[model samples]
Target: MNRRNFLLSTAALALSGCTTASLLKKSTEDTIDYQREKVSGFFASVDGKKLVVLGADYHYVMDQIGDLPQVLQSPLKPRLNAEFSYFDLDHDNHVSGQVTLQLKGKVSDAERQKLQMEGFECKGFQEEVWTKVYKVRGTRYLAKGFELPASVSKFNHDYEIIVRESHSPGVKRAMVLLTPVTLAMDGVLVLGGIVLAPVALIVLSNTHWR
Candidate 1:
C-alpha cells in the first residue's frame, strides 16, 4: 500500500480496536449491574444497619455490592422492601447522639439474639461518646444506643460508631476472605484477554486492509 493508504489503514484499525474495547467494557459493566440487581433483591437493612445476603463464599457479596450498600438504599424499590426506623434523641439534624440501629435478618431466634447482644457492643466511636444495647422481639433485632457530648456549639462535626460482634473479627476477617476471590477475578480477566487477543488482531487486520 502507498504511504497514505498505510496511515489510513492504521487509523482505521485503531478506531475499530477502540470500538471493540468500548463494547467489551460495556459488557463488563452490564454483567456487574446484573449481579448487583440480583444481590440487591435479597439484601435487607434497618436503621442504618445492613444485613448482607451472602453466598457460600460470603466475600463475593462485598465485591459485588461495592462500597457496602448505604443505609438509605434498603427501602427503595427493586431492592428488598425492608423497613428502617431511626430513633434519634438529638433531633438536631446531626448524625450524632443516641441513635438506635435495628436490623432484621434471616437467622434463628437464638442466633439472632446472640447477634443482637454482640452487635450492640460499640465497635468504634467518633466525635462523641456512645454506648449501645440490643433488644430482640421474636425475630427482629434492635440496636439501641446513646451518643453523649452532643454538639454544644454551632461548630458541627460528623462522626460514626460501628457496632459489631467481637467474635466475628469484623472487617479484618472480611478482607482476608475476599483476598482470594479478588485475585481470582483478576486472573479470569487476564485469561479472557489472552484468549481474545488473537481474534481481535485478525479482525482488525481484515478490517484495516479494507
Candidate 2:
C-alpha cells in the first residue's frame, strides 16, 4: 500500500483501540454501581433455628469475576461489625438478622482457600428444596435463592470469613440465586463499541481519498 494510505489505516486502528478501551473502563464502573444497587448494600437470612444474618453485606460474586479486588468496601455508611437479628412480624417464616461484616473488599489467598474448604453445600444434605422469586421490597430487583441443606458446619456456606451463623425461628437457610444484571447491560455497550470500529474501518477504506 502507498505510504499515505498505510499511515491512515494505522491511525484509524489506533483510534479504534482507544475507543474499545474507554468502553471497557466505563462498563467496569457502571457494573460496580449496579452491583451495589441490587443487594441494597446488605441483606439477611435465617438458618435452622437462629438468626444467621441481618443486613448482611456479603458479595458472592466479584465485579470483574476474574480476580477478587485487592480492597472492596460495602456502601454502608460508616461500615462496622454487627451481630443482630429480629423477628419478621410482617411475614411468616421470616425474620430479620442484622449482621455487620468486616470486609475491606479484599480477599487473600488464605481466605480463598478457607472458603473452598467450606464449599457451597450444607450437612451434605439440604432438604425442603424449592424455588421462589425474592424481590427486594422497594425495588424492581428479583433473585432466585435456595434453602441451604441441613449443614454439617455451623454456617451453610462458609464464605471467606462467614462463620457460624444462627438459625432463627421458622426460618430455614436458603441460598439466593442471583444474576449479574449490571454486568450484562454494560457488556452490550462494550459489544456495540467494538462493532462500530470495524464498520468505521470498512467505510474509510471504501471512501475516495484521491
Clashes of each: 1, 23
Candidate 1 global lDDT? 0.26
Name model 1 segments beyond 4 Å from true: 34-210
Residue 71 alpha-carbon offset, candidate 2, angstroms:
25
Over 1-210, each residue of candidate 1 has an lDDT whose tens digit, in order, gives 899999999999999999999998776554321111111112323222322221221211111222123422423112222221221211111111122333333445554454344443324434221223322111111112211122212112221122111221122322121212111232321111221110000001111110
Distance (Å) between predicted and true CA of 43, model 1?
Answer: 13
Model 2: runs farther than 4 Å from truth? 34-51, 56-210
Give residue 91's error in model 2 in angstroms: 24
Using Cα atoms with residue i matched to residue i, what is each candidate's TM-score against the true structure?
0.22, 0.23
lDDT of 2: 0.26
Error of 1 at 99 (Å): 18
lDDT of each residue in 1-210, candidate 2, tens digit only: 999999999999999999999998776554321112111222111111111111224322211111111111222223222221221222122222222123233345655444344331112223311111111111111233422122211222322222223344465545533322221232221111221000000011111211
